[model samples]
Target chain A: MIKVYKELNNILLVNLNIKEASLENGDAFKAEVIKLFDKYHKSIAINMSAVEYIDSSFLGSIVSVFKHLISFQADVVLVGLSKDITNLFALTRLDKVFKIYNSFDEITNQ
Target chain B: MAQLASKQFLLPNTRQSIKASVQEVLDFVINSLPAGVNTEGISFKIEVIIIELLTNGIKHAGTIETFLDVTINEDNINIDKKDFGNRFHPGNITSLLVYDVGHKELLTKDGLHSMYAVVESDTQIRFVCEEENGDEVLDVSNLMEHFGLLIITKSSDTFTYEYDVDTGLNTFSVIIDLN
Candidate 1:
């Protein structure tokens, strides 16, 4: 489950509350994000402070969501990844694809 | 050197069991580690590696049942997982991809001849492949698309695999340094 908040300039901020984003919930997570994107939230920033770890399936879901949003000319950003998760992104070279921020304030203040 | 502790479990086929297995392994690792080890980082890496390996076993092999063994000594954490499923060859990731696509040309040249190659070399060939006309190709997208094996190779200190075609047993072993 995710908490959705709207910031100025129509940036949609979604906070993921899950402890582990793995295969068990990855599909549902992707579906929920797709629903938000379908609602026309063009600029989405996911806050992943609570997510400690993610498996390939979860990462695949994120990639799927990014691909889906790209067709509609929307963009997605990720923020607040823990050290291990950040290393994962770096290992997969996804850090090049997604704009990652350190904090929600950093995303909003910019 | 005698192992400080050892534990083993039969892995269930269901994906739901993956989470439980991860937790079980984490608990064992945390409890077995000697004092002064960097528990937090090692725990995270172990979790990620275990999940990736188990998920691959379940997804690709259709392994109805398997066994996982975890052992810890003063210096290393050893993991051995065995599955009774399709014969698996730990080879160049590109070769696997080509095989998946029903192309046989690259399997012989780029692919590891056997699982022994993976262990003997102490490295799984990855991110290198050939085109149809004998041209070398490097596809970053292919590497990113198949990140599971990359994660496994990057996280573990020593990773190897063995397969018995006659018995249809795939054994993957990893040694993670605890120092």
Candidate 2:
């Protein structure tokens, strides 16, 4: 299950409430985010703090969604990636492509 | 080299089963490591690689069951994952990730630069492009369906795969250094 919250300044925060993000629920997660975007949420922040790990398929879904949102003039940011998850982004060189933050405060401040 | 600890697990191909198996392997690796060795980074990389490889096996290979064998020694940790599924035929594993890049583009400086970002070392990666008659060609469109192979290659110190067509068994082996 995923939790969605609307923060100040119309920022949408979607908490990925899954332990492991893999092929099983990657598509569903993408679908939910697409729904949010379709509803005119220009800014979305995904909270991956609860997620302990993710496979390449899950990561690919995130990238696909990022591209789709960009076409719509919407933006998505990832927050609270664990040390290992951060390492994965760095290894894949996706850190250069996405806007990532350590915490909600960082995103809100920016 | 001497063997310190070894364990094996057989699990169903379901995502839930894979999750439990990964956790079990991670716990075994953490507990088996010698004292005074930092386990945080190793554990994380092991977990990531395990998830990526197992998930690919389940999803792409159409595997019904999988086996995980882990052996930890003073020098390195060895992981062997076997699945009864379709044979994987990609000559170079890293190509599974960057297969979308055209051959012409791959020859250019920018293409090589982008490839370096994903693969840290050129020596460690291998791309098997064949020459048919006179022209060099690589047919890897079917291989690009999955990107987990790239992650598996990058996360391990050494990686290899073998598919026994007769037995219909696919095995992926990875070694991670302890030092």
| Top candidate (DockQ) | 2
How well is each residue in B1-179 modelled by candidate 1, as lDDT tens digits? Answer: 65899999887866778888888889989999888999988887888888988888877778777788999988899888888886565444432422332233322231111111222332222222221231344322232334565566667777766655567667778888887
Per-residue lDDT tens digits for candidate 2, residues B1-179, read 88999988887877877778788889999999877677888977788888877887776678688888999998999998888787664533433333333222121111101122222232122322221231333221212224576676667777766555568767778898888
Clashing pairs in 2: none
**Count of residue pairs whose backbone atoms collide, per candidate:** 0, 0
Best by TM-score: 2
> Model 2 misses residue B147 by how many Å?
3.6
All predictions: root-mean-square deviation over Cα?
6.7, 8.0
Badly placed stretches (over 4 Å) of model 1 are: A70-73, B89-143
How much lDDT does each candidate structure score?
Answer: 0.72, 0.71
lDDT of 1 by residue, A1-110 (tens): 88886655767898999998887898899899999887766778999999976899889788778767766777778989999889888765577678999988998788
Docking class of 1: acceptable
